[model samples]
Target: MGAGRPLEVDLRRVWDAILYINKTGCQWAYLPHDFPPRTTVNYHYIKWMTTGFFARVNAEVRRRVRKKTVETRNRVRGSSTVKASRAPQNLPKNPALTVIKRSRAESIIL
Candidate 1:
């Protein structure tokens, strides 16, 4: 059943090129020569994005990292949690304003 042409480029190189472009925010055409061709990298990137391949990989990696960090995570945050002040007392309160009633003529015109 495997009768198609085999992949000539190393998939790792393609992944590396994608990571390089993502990290540097560089244009696909400006990809370094050490990695696979820009076209190949971009093709894989588009395919991965369209098929949610990157999402799946990210979810798996995130799950593993969270599992490993579970023990250390609780210790990082001490017993007391930081609380933000709802109203700051340092600032002066606004001065009361007096509203002048408009003349009867002005009010009628308006």
Candidate 2:
């Protein structure tokens, strides 16, 4: 019913949520049950996207696989990773909660 467990999240899951959100175009609260909470996932999404962390990762991976320099480059920085324990199951997974959470997260994006 309310936001629960303000904690860090797994980067892997965060990345997956970002991909899922982009691919599915679904609201964050609509994510599948296997995923971490919408808040956790979205929080990391905002953090990484703002820091340009994913851009660096893609460039590095592409360079490794293609054996060529990437046309687009970004500055690399030490991004601190956070590992949160499992999310509290008490809160119901619903769009209303994410709507509130996303309101703040959206400010960062814009």
Candidate 3:
């Protein structure tokens, strides 16, 4: 009785619509008809983005993953961990290209 329409939009449906747009990489105008209206989903997406909701969620997820990885590593290694050397391991010991230093006296004037 209080509202004009009885909250017809479902937030979960809107979320699914947003996910569909992200997965398919399609324009808002191309959003499928199965989900809530594109305007509804787009509005929620913009609101969340502007309020830093996605950034906070991403940071929390990364923190949890890093903590779990460290815990697993410590448990498996038993406190004796080997750290990598300062130099990167991927480089070849003998490089293909070598620089030859030339002095002023060595210059051949044309």
Candidate 4:
């Protein structure tokens, strides 16, 4: 939810953090400090659990393994909300142009 501070956690690290939490049955707050903050991992996990994402991932992996086939499609994907940036970086600075510009202009007009 980006409630306090937006997190930029790696996907692999987040999964490892989740596995640590689940396998250990530790309280979310008590997650090892070396992993991404517990709340961040929990936030993502709850979101995925709610959206049936884990089911899809499991099914895909199982199918690939059973078939002994290389993945033709991506193995997993987060929800649209999860993929959304903390801030909309591509918003148009000059709406009339229908063009997005960085805070600092690409070039100055004479």
Per-model RMSD to reference? 11.7, 31.6, 11.4, 21.5
Candidate closest to the true structure, highest TM-score: 1
Question: Which digits, one per residue and each the tens of the lDDT, describe model 2 over residues 1-110?
Answer: 46997546666877787888899899987998778888878777788889998899999988786653332222112122122234454877899888989998999899
- Write the residue-wise lDDT of candidate 4 on 35-81 in tens digits: 88777788889998999988999999898796664442233233444
Runs in model 2 with CA error above 4 Å? 1-8, 68-110
Scored by lDDT, the top model is: 1
Query: Clashing pairs in model 4?
Result: none
Q: 1 or 3, which is superior by TM-score? A: 1
TM-score of each: 0.61, 0.49, 0.55, 0.52
TM-score of 3: 0.55
Instruction: Tell me model 4's lDDT, rounded to 2 decimals.
Output: 0.75
| Predicted structure 4: clash tally | 0
- Over 4 Å off, model 1: 1-3, 73-110
Clashing residue pairs in candidate 2 (N, C-alpha, C atoms within 3 angstroms): none
| lDDT per residue as tens, model 3, 2-100 | 858667789789878887888999899999899988888888899999999879978999999999999998876864444444446787644333322
